[model samples]
Target: MIIVALDPPQNVDVEKWIKIRYDELKEYVQGFKIGVPAIIRVGLEGLSKIFKDYSGLLIADLKLADIGDVMALTASIVGDYGFNAVIAHAFVGYSQAVDELSKTCEKKGLKLILVVSMSHRGSEEFIDKHLESFVEIAKRVGSWGLVAPATRPLIIKRVRELIGSEVKILSPGIGVQGAEPGTAICYGADYEIVGRAITHSENVKQSALKIIENQKQRVAKCRG
Candidate 1:
C-alpha cells in the first residue's frame, strides 16, 4: 500500500509536480498525502481541482493539536473540504479529543489517522519519552490508523499488540530514509508512505514501479 507524500515546499513548481506525477498516481498508491506545503500552496480550491479528476484517498495532514471540540471542528471542516482522512496529533490532545474527532469523521464517513510518531531525526526522544502512554491513548481513541517510522521494530510490535489488527499503521521513513518497503512490512507496517524517493526521482514512473516491485518481492518473501 502506497501513500505518496505531496509535501514539496512552496517554492517547488506545484503544477509541474502534479503534472509529472499525474500518470504514475494510480491505484498503486492508496492515498495522496497533503502536508504543510501542499495545503499551503493549494488550499481547498486546489484540493477540489485536483480531486475533480483524480480519484484516490486524500489525506489532510493538518496534524491538528487542539482541544476536543476544536479537533472535532477541524476534522469536520477538513472532511467538508473533501478530504477522505485527516491527521491528528496524538500526544498533545486527550482521549476525548480522539473520541470527538473519531465521532466527527465517522459521521461524515471520513478517517482520522492519528500521528503516534513522526519520521524525523529527533523523533526517538519525543516518542520514546511517552511511548507506552501514547500507544494506550491510540488504542483507546480508535482512530483509523497510526503513523510511525517504519524502522522502529519494537514500537510497531507493541502498537499492533495493543490494537490487535484493528488499527492500521501508515509507516513512513522508507526509501530516502533507508528503510525499504519490504523491511517495513517485515517489521509489521501496514502501509508505506513514500515522498522524495519517488517524487524527486529522474524517472518518476520507473521509480514508483521499482518501489512497487520491491514491495511485492518483500511481501512474497514475508508470506513464504
Candidate 2:
C-alpha cells in the first residue's frame, strides 16, 4: 500500500496537484496523505470536496501533539471530517496522547498511525535512544499501527518484533529518499509511503504505477 503525501505545490498553478494526483492514480496508492499544508492551503471546504470526489482512503497527517483531551478532540474532528486515519506524535504526550486518540479513533472506527520516526536528519538522536519507550507505548495504547521512516528498515523490524505482528507498520522513505518501496516491504513494511516520488513526478500516474508494481514484486518475492 502506498500512501502518497500530497504536499503543497511550489507554484500557484501547481496547487491543484493533490486533486490531479488523486484523479489520475487513486487506484495505485492505498490512500492520500493530507497534511497540514494541504488543509491550510485548500481549507476544510476544499478538503471535503476532494474527499467527495476521491473515493479512496484519506490520512490526515496532522501530527497532533497536545493535551490528551485536546488531542483526542482534534483527532475526532479529523475522523468526523472523513479521514480514514490520522497521525500523532509518539513522544508528544506518550501514553496519554495515544490512549485518548486511540479511544476516539476506535469509537469512530478509524486508524491512528503514530509517528515513531520521522524522515529527517534532525530526528535521529531522540528516536535512536527512546525507540523502545515508543514501542512500549504503542503496545499499551492499542493503536492500529505505526508510521516510521522506511529509511531504517532494520529498526522497523526490531520495533515490530517488540510490538508484535498485529501492529502494522507504515513506512515513508521511498522515492525522494531513494529507498525502494519493495525493499521496505521486504523488511516488514505493511504499507509503504512514497511522497515526492509520485506526487512531484513529471507523470504522477506513471510514478504511482511504478510503486504499485514494486509492491507486487515484493509480495511475489516474499511468497517465493
Q: Which number leads on lDDT? A: 2
Report, for every candidate in turn, its global Cα lDDT versus the true structure.
Answer: 0.77, 0.78
Q: Please give, for residues 77-184, the per-residue lDDT of candidate 1 as tens digits.
A: 777777888888888755567777778888987887887776776878776667667777777767788887776756676667766677888888888887877666
Q: Write the per-residue lDDT of candidate 2 for residues 1-224, one digit (tens) a residue.
A: 78788886666643476677778877666788888977888876677777775666688888888878888888778777778888888887565667888898888878888877776776687865677787787777887778877787787777777778888888888878867767667877788888888887899898788788877897788768
Candidate 2 wrongly placed segments (more than 4 Å): 13-15, 53-55
**Steric clash pairs (candidate 1):** none
TM-score of each: 0.91, 0.92
> Model 2: how far is 1 from its true place, Å?
2.0
Candidate 1 segments whose C-alpha is farther than 4 A from its true place: 53-55
Q: How displaced is residue 101 in candidate 2, in Å?
A: 1.9
